[model samples]
Target: QQQVRQSPQSLTVWEGGTTVLTCSYEDSTFNYFPWYQQFPGEGPALLISILSVSDKKEDGRFTTFFNKREKKLSLHIIDSQPGDSATYFCAASMSNYNVLYFGSGTKLTVEP
Candidate 1:
């Protein structure tokens, strides 16, 4: 079974600080990696993603560092703000597989 795991299930950061979330997966067949952010009563929204062929992907203040060999990845949130508080889920899927395996999630709180 494909499984994804995340550490420090919850995190707290001061505004303007950086937040880091760690995630790991079991399946080597997984190719696509995506991170989603969900707020109360709202569906998750894609934050950033990276391919197996890529080691790092960044957009604005969000960055995903991937390690294909170890089947691990880390999501970094820079310049954190109070509005950034949310639950983040790390997910992985294969190009041919329609299912996405997601980590438990990391709830982040940014203190202003």
Candidate 2:
């Protein structure tokens, strides 16, 4: 069973636009959420994250929103650039554990 579910397997966004990737989880025990960004031939890197207690978090062009009540979360990238083209993954984990459950990922293409 997939614990985390991500939508829109692929997405295309124009430069300077905003790209949104969303995910939902079945586990209410998940206390930490992180969104990872990966480029071709490279490992995924932590882009941004939010804890269960936080409703939203922001870092430069990236932002993450958590909705614990709905068991959902979303990552937003503003001013999307060509370099931002990559696979975005949403992951969840319990605060006490190091294990992470990842979604299928959303491949974002930023068109210049």
Candidate 3:
């Protein structure tokens, strides 16, 4: 069974627009939420993360929000550019372990 579920398998956005990606998890034990960005040939890199204790986290133009009660999380990209076009994966993990449960990912395209 899939522990984490992500919506909108693919997405398209115009340059300088906002991009929103969401995900939900079945496990309530998940404490750490991380969003990863991957290019065509490169590995996924940690973009931003938030702990269950916090409601939101922001890094530059990227922000991640977590709802512990609802077991839902979202990643928001403001002023999205062509360089931000990539596959984004939402993952959940416990605070004590390194294991991660990842969603299928959302393919994002930023049209210039």
Candidate 4:
């Protein structure tokens, strides 16, 4: 199956807390790893990404830690804020560069 499964479709965190989202894939050929973030009534944007060759990627408050050997990955948001409250989708692809398998998305609300 070409499905990338994610858990806890929603998460609530404090403004100064940390949030974690998880994802797993069944595609053995998957190569591209991308994390998209979205806000209310907006399109998803590429927050951070890592090639299958890399295991971790960090960009400021957002970080993606991947385990290619285990077919699993996670996105961590440090010092989450109300502005960070949105949907996080973990996606995977096999170099298709067009069709990306996206998780259902986790809705995170950071309380201030």
- Cα displacement (angstroms), candidate 4, residue 109, comes to 0.4
In model 4, where do residues sit more than 4 Å from their true spots?
none
lDDT of 3 by residue, 19-99 (tens): 999999998889999999999999999999999999999999999998888889999999999999999999999999999
My TM-score estimates for the predictions, one after another, are: 0.97, 0.98, 0.98, 0.94
User: Which residue pairs in candidate 1 collide?
Assistant: none
Residue 112, candidate 3: alpha-carbon lDDT:
95
Lowest lDDT 10-mer window, candidate 4?
1-10
**How many clashing residue pairs appear in each of the predictions shown?**
0, 0, 0, 0
Q: What C-alpha lDDT, on a 0 to 100 scale, does residue 40 get in candidate 1?
A: 94
Quick one: how many clashes does candidate 2 have? 0
Predict model 3's lDDT versus the native.
0.95
Candidate 4: tens digits of C-alpha lDDT, residues 19-103: 9999999988989889999998999999999888888899998889999889999999899989998899999988866689999
Q: Provide the lDDT at 78 for model 3.
A: 98
Model 1 segments more than 4 A misplaced:
none
